[model samples]
Every structure is written in structure tokens, then in C-alpha cells.
Target chain A: MIYEEVLSGHQQELRRGTVVMAALATLETPGYGYGLLAVLEKSGLSVDANTLYPLLRRLEKQGLLDAEWDTTESRPRKMYKTSQSGRSLLDSLTAEWNYLATSLNALRSEEPNTPLKELP
Target chain B: MSSLSSRYVTAVSRSVPESQREDVEAEVAAAIADLREARLDAGTPPEDVERAVLLELGDPMRLAADYSNKPLHLIGPDYFPTYIRLLKILAATVLPVVAFAVMLGKLLSGGDAGEIASGGIIAGLGVAMHMFFWVTLIFALIERNPGSKEAKPKWDPTTLPDTPPGGVRLGDTIAAILVALVAVAYLPWQHFNSPFTDAQGQSMPTLNTELWPFWIPLLMLGLLATAVLEFIRYRAGGWSWRFVAINAILELLVAVPVVWLAATDSLFEPRFIGRLVTEGWLDASLHLNVTIIIITIGVVIWNLIDPLRKVRRDTAMRAKRVGSLG
Candidate 1:
């Protein structure tokens, strides 16, 4: 329960920043909305449309994404790719995220009795 | 096939802007359709596919709304406080330019103080018009998009008040009308002679002409038209292509004329620009002012036209697609 509470709070927020990176990384090859969602789910980061659609728009607005409509099929799909700016941002964020992960892991390991202490 | 999948897709397509919606809808529908097809291909009964797809798609309105990229706030996402704030700033900045332009015009035209004041206010109003239209547009788009965080700092959904946002109220309207009436009352006469004298002591040329060459009136008219259009859209709770077409037409009608007049020096006095160049700022500021005005006009045209072009192109494309589909 404590682990769940911690995950739903601080850990989730920290992971939230990764959504952009995850989205950008997945979208580098040009994926549509549902396509990206499937990729996210496969990668263990579930994204709802309510979050992804707006995030995509925001990223595009910020010049981090380039999108185009593919209408060759029976239905059309808007495909998005990472822009040059997004690539750069993603690179930086990835490095920072890795560093944070390492640092957090080190801290967790340093506290040898941390998990034991949390027991009721 | 169950009607649910078709209904769901149709609903999703509606909330989204037409230009990109087709592809979006296709992707979504195809995803569902593929599943249905697979079930049939796998020897599963087709009757159950509709229920499954409908259930998976969830509420048509919410799914479409989410897909539409409409903002989360009740007030809407397309509207932004920062945009409004910028508009106010632009309005403030444009007023002085208008005042200076009108004052110089009045002095050149040999108008009374009242005429100068009225012209200045009109100029301010013109700037206000541009501020209103562009700002409203930017905010409206922001409001429409549920995903925009541009207004995140200022807009709060959980605590959003039940009443509509307060803007220019009845008192403000009355005040504006009174001001306009004053401007009309203080109109410059046809025969008021110029007070400007060149450094060489020769009398400056008269400023009297058929009209004032300021772009303010056109900007005002565009704003007024847009306001009326928005009011209609507001009451109706939706927008139509016809409304957009009318808005675009109004913008062109007002902007093109005012810009033409300002560029040609036909509206104010024929001699206004000439005197301002020859007499004001020893002519350098006149050149600079003209450049600034031209640049401003260019920017306004670009900003205003860009959205209209997108809207028109998207709407046309949608129509073509729908036609083809039929």
C-alpha cells in the first residue's frame, strides 16, 4: 500500500516528464495517435488520449514535432515525428533522466533498511 | 455491422478540425474496423463485434472531444489569458502611434484641438480593433484545444466561476459610444488653415482633404464585425463555415480598404503625408513612421490571413472528401 501510494504520487510525477521523451522517441519514425499509444503501452508507459493528443499538439506548437496527414488508406491518420528541436530536448532529458534514476537507485540502496522500515 | 462504430467515428470526426480529422478518424476507425474484420475472419460471429467496438471506443462525445484536441477547461482551451494580456499591451502601444499620427495630421490640416483629440481616440480605437480581433482569435483557438497549457497558470477548471467572463460591460459600451459621439461632434472643419510654418518662414501647405488616411476605421470595422459574428456563434453554441466566410470577408473588406487608403494617402488629406514628410521630423521620422506603418500593416495582414487560409483550405478539403465519400 505504501509502495503504491509513493508510486502514485512522487514517482508518477517524475515519470510524467518521461512521457514527452517516450512520445518523441516513439514518434521519431512517424506514428499516429493510437499507434503511439500502442507503443507506449508496449514500453510499459500507458498514455490516455486525453493526455497524448494535447501533449502532441503542445510539442508541435513548441516546434518539437512535425506532423502530417496520411490519407492513402480508407481512413486518414495524422502522423507525427520528432523535430530537430525535439531531438535535442529529448537527448538532454534522457541524460538527465538516466542520471536521476541512477542517483535515486544509489540512494535507495544506501538506505539498506528503507523497505524494512516501511513495514507495518 | 452495428451502427455504433459508424456513429462513434462520426462523432469523433466532428470535434476535430476538418483538415486533419480525416486522417485521425481513419486511424481510429481503421483500428476498430480491423478488429471487427479480424473477429469475422477468425470465424467469430459479426453480431458481437459492434458491441465490443462500441464498448472499447467508450463515449462517442468524450472520445471525439479527446481526439479533437479541444482543451479541458469549461471556458475552453483556445482562449488564453496571456493572449488577452498581450492584446491589451498591443492596444496600449498602438494608441500612441495613432495619436501621434492623428495629431500630426490635425496640425498639418490646421484643425482645432477637438479634432486632434477625436482623431487620436479614433486611432486608439483602431489599434483596439486589431488587438480585439487577433487576441480573441488566439484565445478562441486556445480555448478550443483541450490540451493547451498556455493558459494553465491563469485558468482553473475546478474553481471556474459559473458566470461568463466579464469584459466590456454596459457602462463600457455607453462610455465608448459617448466618446465616439464626441469625436463626431469635434470633427474638423473644411476650411481650418494649417498652423505649420517651415524653418525658412514660408507657410506650410494645408492639411484639408476628403478623408483621414488612418487604417483605424477599417480595423474598427473588422473588430465590430468579428464581435457581432462571435455573438451569433456564442448564441448558437457552434460555428458554421458561413460564419467563418463572413468573418473572413469582413476582415478583407475593412482591412484592404484601410490599408489601401493609408498606403495611398487618399483618406486623411491628400497633402497629409506630404506635409508630414516635408515638415514633420525634418522628414526622417516621416519615412520611419511610414516604414513602421507598412510593417505593422504587413504583420496584421499576415497574421489575419494565415488562419483564414488554413480554415478555408481545411473546410474545402473536408467538403471534397465528404463529396467523394458520398
Candidate 2:
């Protein structure tokens, strides 16, 4: 019932789904899980290894992500990328999201609250 | 424990698949290290920091659940309500029956009626328990919407088993039934009809109960049918509502003989509850009987619900995939 707790939990879950798409989008150029997390954070997404690792797996399972081991370093790191199918799906989801957002905005603007009048 | 940590990580890693473990462990290890560093920055005591980090990591059971996308309960969201309702209904039927069996055992042993509450209270509690379970189940189901990824963790099927191993094979089930027959049928019949008498010349209760011969074969046949069905499942891809249908048929078959015996005053004498009070051995026998019936029914219903629900889900998923392609 704590408002901050509820807000943060809700926000965390909301971001988790998008993390897959984000990872794939970033991995259009090959990056590992930690690398992807860093990219996400740089892009203002703020993902951690716990969250990113599972998202990577889910995306890979869906055949939207592909991985290969990079053992050249002292420790091997699995690098991932956006698969062909993944790119196509990402494009579709992105377009659909934008369209949905536009429609939602139109619907909200028509509401009788007169907040539009108060706005410059 | 710090030295053992890598082993623990490796064990957990192996518990998943070989392909995913190393990277997953590295990430997990990094997160642990990060938490440790953060604790150090906060100037937390060294001893407390390790414990805090461990606690913050959460239980490995939950971590595995997170990784595997395992729901808290065996049943999925869609069928959870119906499953809970069925459990409630079964629990309702089972409680008073068990209570009655217990009460009968007590009564037959010359215990006071006051010691046993009337059947109404038991029945009511059973119904209430049933409703409570279903209500919670319905709420949980309603809460599960794919649109809302709120508590839904992203699931990767590649790291998980294609199918859960939580199924009873027909052969093993058959073997269990055979064991039950030996214990319930052969041993008791041998004891009851054995030519030898005890020192007091009073024979053990043995298989003198009229329900003995009929119940044994009836139960065994039920189990045998299940074994055969599981065999078919192992050999083939599809085994639909066979488990449930078979169980229901067995229950009906057993019920008829049970009702007849009870009505004719041959069984349920002084009630199974009265027997519990009268003969401690009888109490134990009834306990075993009730346990077997309850377990069989539970397993059958669970088996029935999970597969059919999965079939529906897979069908829906396939449709979605096709739709997406189109």
C-alpha cells in the first residue's frame, strides 16, 4: 500500500518487457549481457544484469536474438545480436506502439477536463 | 561459503542448461559483487555485509522460479480457477467423510458423541474452504493478463525443458497399484482366511470385511487402466482426458459397490468413523484406504487439467503465430 513501493514495482515491470526490444535494438550491433546493460543505462533505460540476462534469454528463445561465445578474452563472454526475425518483429512492434500512442493521445485530448484550455 | 559460492553457481548453472550457465553465472556473480561493493561504500560492517548480500539475493528457489518462469503453483492462470474449484469440491466431500471415519472409529471404541461434532459443521467448513480457495484462484487468474507484464517475468524456453517432468508414467503407476493390491488384497485375505488362529483363538480382523474382495480388484483394475494409458502416452504424442475419464469411471465403479454395501448394512457399519474408535487397527486401515482414494483422485484430476489446459494454450499460441505471420 506504500505509494512509492507500488509506483516503483509497477514501473519495474513495465520496463522489463521493453528491455527485450531494447536489447535487440541495441544488439543490432553485437554486445554481451553486461555490454547490453551498459548500453541500456547509457540510453537512460537503467537495466541490471539480473534483469538483462533473463530478457536476453527470453528474446533468444523467441528466435529474435542469437548468441555466440567470445572466448578470446581471459573469461569467455556470450555475445548476442538481433536475429533477422527479431529486427522484423521490432520494426512492427515499434510502429504499432507509435500508432497506439498517437491514438491514445487523440482520445485523451478530447476529454472534457478543460486542461487543454489551461495549457498554452 | 565464499569458496563454495562458485560451486553453488556451477550447480545452479548445470541445473539449467550447459549453453546458458556460464554467462548467467558471471552476470549473477557480478551483481553479487556489485551489491557487496555498494555495501562497502555504505560503510556497513564486514560481517553483516555478506549476510545482507545473501539475503538481498533472495532464496535460490525463487531465483530458479524467476529464471525458469515457474509459477508459484503447478496450475497455470487460465485453469487455476476451475482447478481450485475442483479441489474445493473434493476437499468438501473428503473432509466429513474422513471426519466421519474418525468419529466412527471413536464411537465404536465407546467414546462420547460430544467428542465428535455433527457432520453439518464439517460439511460447512468443507464448503467454505472450497469457496475460499476458488475465490483466491479466480482473483489470481483475473490478475494474469498478457497485456500487463507487471509481475510477468520474460520467459526463455530455450533454457527450459520443453515439457515438465512432473508426470506419473503408466508403468510406475501400475506397479504402485500392484503393490497396493498385495498389501490390501493378498496379505489381508491370507491373514483373515488363514487356517491358523491366534493364542486367544480370536483371529485378526483380517479380510472379513465384505468390501475386501470387490474393492481390491476394482481399485487394481482402475490402477491397471491408468498404467496402460500412461504406456500409450509414452509411446504416442497425444493422451488427452484419458486420465480423468478413467479415474471418474473407477470412482463411479467403486462408489456403486460402496453405496450398496453401506445401504445393505454390510459396510459403513457403525460408520467407518465408529470403526476408528473401536479398533485402532481398523482406524489405520481406513486411514490408508482414504489416503489412497484421495491421492488417486487428486493425481488424476491434476493430470487431466494440466494437459488439456496446455493443449488449449499451445493451440492458441499456434494460432497467434499464424496470425502474426499473416
Top of the candidates by TM-score: 2
Model 1 over residues A13-117: C-alpha lDDT tens digits? 867888999998888898876678767888889875456765776688789999877788666656789999999999998898889889889868877887678
True contacts kept of each: 0.15, 0.04
Over 4 Å off, model 2 = A111-120, B1-4, B14-58, B73-76, B101-111, B114-326
For each candidate, give its TM-score against the true structure: 0.36, 0.45
Q: Give the alpha-carbon lDDT of every model.
A: 0.64, 0.61
Q: What tens-digit string does per-residue lDDT give for candidate 2 at B142-222?
A: 445445336543445574436543334556555745654564455446545654344456444433355556664674565
| Candidate 2 lDDT (Cα, 0 to 1) | 0.61
Candidate 1 accuracy as TM-score: 0.36
Say which docking band candidate 2 falls in.
incorrect
Candidate 2 TM-score over all chains jointly? 0.45
> Chain B in candidate 1 has what TM-score?
0.28
